[model samples]
Target: MFNCNWGFMTGFGPGGGMGGFGFLFNLFIFGLLIFLAYKLIQRLSRPDGTRDREDSLEILKRKYANGEITTEEFSRMREILRS
Candidate 1:
């Protein structure tokens, strides 16, 4: 005689015998994934200089050293950045 698995098929199904805990667990996992993605997007959207810790003063120095700006312009820009 073949018997039907009503206990595992009818109300609860095969997602473990726990009543509604399986659904709750899946929901928790989905929420955690969303939270992680939001955090990742926020981090990626930020400017690279903030992450690299490059300051405006350092950039001005590099520009002056590269001869991209005159000495007077470099000093003025450096003063502006320091303020």
Candidate 2:
């Protein structure tokens, strides 16, 4: 004789509750997916070495503005960067 009870199938059987662990597991997976997507987007937004070159130029400008480099040195580096 087959038992007709289906409570276990619905997590309603004796000692069947997951005690909220299932919700936590799903939340963790969702957060991991979101983090991975953000990282992928950030990585794809930069094209080739342009971003690095621009960043270097910006740093160079900052150094010149802060008086960390002489006019001749700044002009020399600026010319080097343009090439």
lDDT of 1 by residue, 1-83 (tens): 99676433333456555658755766677799999999999999997666343477778789999999999998888776655
User: Which numbered prediction scores highest in lDDT against the true structure?
Assistant: 2
lDDT of each: 0.73, 0.78
For candidate 1, the per-residue lDDT at 69 reads 97
- lDDT (C-alpha) at residue 1 in model 2: 94
Which stretch of 10 consecutive residues in model 2 shows the poorest summed lDDT? Answer: 5-14
Clashes of 2: 0
lDDT of 2 by residue, 1-83 (tens): 99675533434334546635645655677799999999999999977788888889999999999999999999999898877
Clashing pairs counted in every model: 0, 0
Residue 35 local lDDT, model 2? 100
Task: Evaluate candidate 2 by giving its C-alpha RMSD to the native, one decimal.
Answer: 7.0
Once model 1 is optimally superposed onto the true structure by TM-score, how far is the C-alpha of residue 13 displaced, in angstroms?
A: 6.0
What is residue 4's positional error in candidate 1, in angstroms? 22
Q: Each candidate's root-mean-square deviation in Å? A: 10.2, 7.0
